[model samples]
Target: MGSRLNPYLSFRGEARQAMEFYREVFGGTLTISTFGDFGNPDPALADQVMHSQLETARGFTLMGSDTPPGMDLVVGNNITVSLSGDDADDLRGWWDRLSESGVVSVPLEKQMWGDEFGQCVDRFGIGWLVNISQPQS
Candidate 1:
């Protein structure tokens, strides 16, 4: 598949509710996973959504996740531009450019989910999330 650009929203505890609302309005398949599904960082957030994906038949893809404690979360800056696909070279090229002169909050590296991922805030203060997915078997 080709690279995708989408918005990834950050919620303090409303990801599940928000994603569900979108699903209701857009009519699509919604998949959600709780923090516990990926080894809950805080017991209190075990039931909080770690990730939620809504893909509509119209080709709209929305992703969101509840922020765990200790993460910097500014209300107005809760949205991130997500770039993801299986093309590592292409993804890395974009990552290099977006992160240059920008603060990389999360260094690009192999994540626990078997993918290379990173998060950064661009020089313009726009947040970016890049994930180089693993090849499907």
Candidate 2:
């Protein structure tokens, strides 16, 4: 029950699709709650995801929710979720999954920074930055 910080994405009405796609890519236990599952207060959004959490064995937690009826979804370039570590194999695997069906702004390759770095915008328009640091000599 410790405090945790994770990215919370906001989608207009594609939260379920995006989250499910993430579950497939990250290999995690995904739990999603819908507005109807709550109390049937909003019939229109009853089927839409009220909240979703993906906790992967890789120790990554991604949470997201659909924007309520009145809320505006302004997915700007203000934020980009970043993944960085020394696990080349694992990180590259994630890069392959994330970069799939999306736009790769920077190809994942050995960067001048001495790491495998790249950036991509997922099909849901979520920006991601992955960096696999090389072992120090």
Q: What is the TM-score of each candidate against the true structure?
A: 0.55, 0.95
Residue range 33-73, candidate 2, lDDT tens digits: 99899986877899999999999987899999999878878
Displacement of residue 51 (Cα, Å) in model 2 is 0.8
After aligning candidate 2 to the native by TM-score, how far in Å is the CA of 103 from where it should be?
Answer: 0.8
Cα RMSDs of all predictions?
A: 12.7, 1.1
CA deviation > 4 Å runs, candidate 1: 77-137
lDDT of 1 at 49: 92
Give lDDT per model, in order: 0.82, 0.92
Q: Residue 5 in model 2: shift from native, Å?
A: 0.9
Query: What's the lDDT for residue 24 in model 2?
Result: 87
lDDT of 1 by residue, 25-119 (tens): 45689999998899866789889998889998868798889888899777656567778888798678778877887799999999999999999
lDDT of 2: 0.92
